[model samples]
Target: MQSRGRYHRTVLLVLVRTVWIAVCAAVLVVSGIAWSTVSTISNGVERSFAIPEDAPRSSSGRNILIMGLTTRLDLHGEPLPDDVLRRMQAGESDRGGYNANTLILLHIPASGPAIAMSVPRDNLVPLSSGGEGKIKEAYGRAKVAEEERLQAAGQHDKRTLERAGREAGRRAQVQTVATFLNQPIDHLVEISLIGFFHIAEGLGGVDVCLKNATKDPLSGADFPAGRQHLDAGQSLSFVRQRHGLPNGDLDRTKRQQAFLSAVARRLKGADVSAMQAMIDMAKQDVVLDSRFDLADFARNVPTEVRFETLPVEGGARVDGLDVNKVDPEKVRKKVTELAKEPPPPPSNDGIPCID
Candidate 1:
């Protein structure tokens, strides 16, 4: 039982961290907050140079990449507090490395609902770090290489090394995804797994629906069919259950989409004080590109936001690693087609049901 519990917690941490792209956006500038509060929150957020000051702007809209690192470590590479680790049910600092397990691109067009595209982490593609590998590896690969270079250069402080290495990682990750999807990244929002738990806690909890009664020992998800509310831990379990699903990681992607949808709905009716508190929590976990304007985004954010996964040809193995096979041209064309469609109508539906 002890061994099983540890394995469960380990998988729980890995999978749950793969979502929460929504948390960064949804928590940062929910529509009703005061401008002063939004400005303060924006200023308090840690900034990154992943997107360059003179990077080419998107002609039609702004594209923001929200990268969620699988690392169990915090932004500064320190282990999370014991209390936080206990609450997250995650393992010690060694469990997850520096992979960007979750990559979501949000395109806020000049005049319509924003579209969020989720890119599966295991998609095999040419990485900016070197040759072909999982898209998720681009971050860690660049990070390690930069750290090694920095070590040779005599910058030996641990935190300083980690910070510089992470900046390289972020830049590589942003460029890799932009090349893959053929889009310009105007800004970036980076977070670690713990941010998911913190955002959920701020919401007080969330409501999710599953299509069938299910139990997954690996992810620690055991819930009955139909609409059910979950506390922060259970909410993590909710998005983490992919082992028993027919589509595996693909289904997990949909679960993440539904979760963000539910978050958006909840925020619409959330108390002003609660929203402010959530923003406060977010500032601790999120890092945004220096150029992102939170106040303008708060005022102009669309009422309807749509989520979809980038098309993958299928699954394949390369060098003994399982990866999603994606056709780059097909992906770019698909994105172009999606861009041409009119914004989707607002969903009056409540919590979305998922398998």
Candidate 2:
């Protein structure tokens, strides 16, 4: 009887071990599937952009320009109404022109965290052509000129508008921002204003923290202190508000950086099941330059990337508009500092947008 009991006990132990092994194997398979799905969704959203294959490999690393086009061609190829266009052309009050309100330059070093620099839209800089204007105006002017030419040639208005918008996006803005970088910018990513809102909504909104109370009628943003979860419309207004910010454009640029950081954090936290939500968001309101391949890149971007903003001083104004003029000597020095192998820690505070 004792021998039989021992045999039965041993058999039961073996069975339990086998079951545990099977459970572990199943768990692993499910985890892998989930990870893959998340990666695919993220890449799909980003793949619309055109990333150059032969982009120069940097020993120190490469830079990417994340441009937000102010044109009405968000994901749906929608154009602004004629009345709105007329008001914008006449420089009427409250009419935001077709110009890039946000410009961010991302410097990804071969090693360490990525640095993001924001350029204020009102920055006064000499254009490639003689004379100075708001940096945002360059692309808008190019777009307007292209449309006028197409109209004069008696082309189909819709088709011509589409072509003109594309040309304006590629030639006027992206190229101009690259030129301003004064360094070899390897990749360019353009995201429309609507794209940002859709992405936020898709992710179930983003949490934003304001150090103080703020209100801006122009951007329709109103917030009172502390952490607040913002939906799509609120998120857009939060990042767009500039009038009430104490530092004007400088403060707005900082808010944008904070918002992007929050977004990156939120995306990293999303589970594999959220893939559908991501895909829906991309399909609805996102467009990318033709070079990026979402599937491939998504697999490689581990959730450990670091984010930093570009440093700038707010001391100048042009034509009553606040401008964060790039300190050439400071920028050159900073760039050189970044070129060193295993780049140094990012300087905290005083970073602005690259637009």
Candidate 3:
């Protein structure tokens, strides 16, 4: 017969294991939502996407590009409803175009820490087809180019044409970022405003930390120093606000990272209800490029994902706009160094006080 102490310890162990399993299940629920459904086209254009066989990969490295688009329009370039616009708290009106406001290149090394490096939207770079402009504008330009090319080819199917244009846009955006960083990209995950809102709502609320009292009138973000929970509206504000941030766009980039950190943690334990809410919301707002297999990626998730910003000298005046000046080679070297660094100490329940 087992001793009383041993029996109690065994019972405690079982309870702990049960709770851990439940949490893992909850976290995976949101991840289970497929990206293929995230972008739907009624016009029925069946296209397949995959990385080239000779594309770079290593036994220890994986690079993925995760971008956030700035637009109030659906994938078809149509505007969202007033009610959703209000809930999203997106600062600007829907002008019916797209620009990548957030561009993060994530490096998940097979045997080391995962790094999420941010490339500011204002990073001025040469487009693949030639000419210099803010990197973010590539999406809109590519979409227009694809549409015109298809039209000239006598393919007048509007739905089919529009989806093709967006796919081309995705390809362009990924290439631009990858080339800028001098890195090879294997996958792309782009999330829209509505999907993000639903995701925040689905998770109940995401928790974020502030280092100092902050209020950005533009993004409409107001928060006190320390940790706090944010609803969908406020969470959007938290990541989008840049006007009052100390380093302007760079600080906003950091905020985006902190928010994602919390989201990464929340995703691990988000209940079925929360996951379903995001799934429902995503039906109209998320796009996972055809090459990525979400199920496989989720199952082989890294032990940790850390966020950082690419090295930059600072902002400079260019074409009457403040743009971040970055050395592509230097940035690439920095990331190569990052791959070998150890992961930071275990974060709080989520990342803490990321001010």
The candidate that wins on TM-score is 1
Candidate 2: regions farther than 4 A off: 1-59, 76-95, 268-274, 299-305, 311-320, 338-355
User: Can you rank all candidates by lDDT, best first?
Assistant: 1, 3, 2
Alpha-carbon error at 329 in model 2, in Å?
3.3
The residue-by-residue lDDT of candidate 1 on 1-355, one tens digit each, is 6554333322221112212335323333322344454466667778888888877778888787888787778888998888887777656777778898778888777886667788988998899877999999999999999999999998899999999999999999999998898888888888887876776776777888889888888767789999988878776766666788878888888877777666655654555454555665566777888887765665555545577788899999898988999999998887877765634644545566788
Write down the worst ten-residue block by lDDT for model 1: 10-19
RMSD of every candidate to native, in Å, equals 8.5, 12.4, 7.8
lDDT of each: 0.74, 0.53, 0.65
Please identify model 1 stretches exceeding 4 Å from their true place: 1-33, 342-348
| lDDT (tens digit, per residue) of candidate 3 on 135-189 | 8888879888989999999999988887888777777887787778778887666
Per-residue lDDT value at 340 in model 2: 44
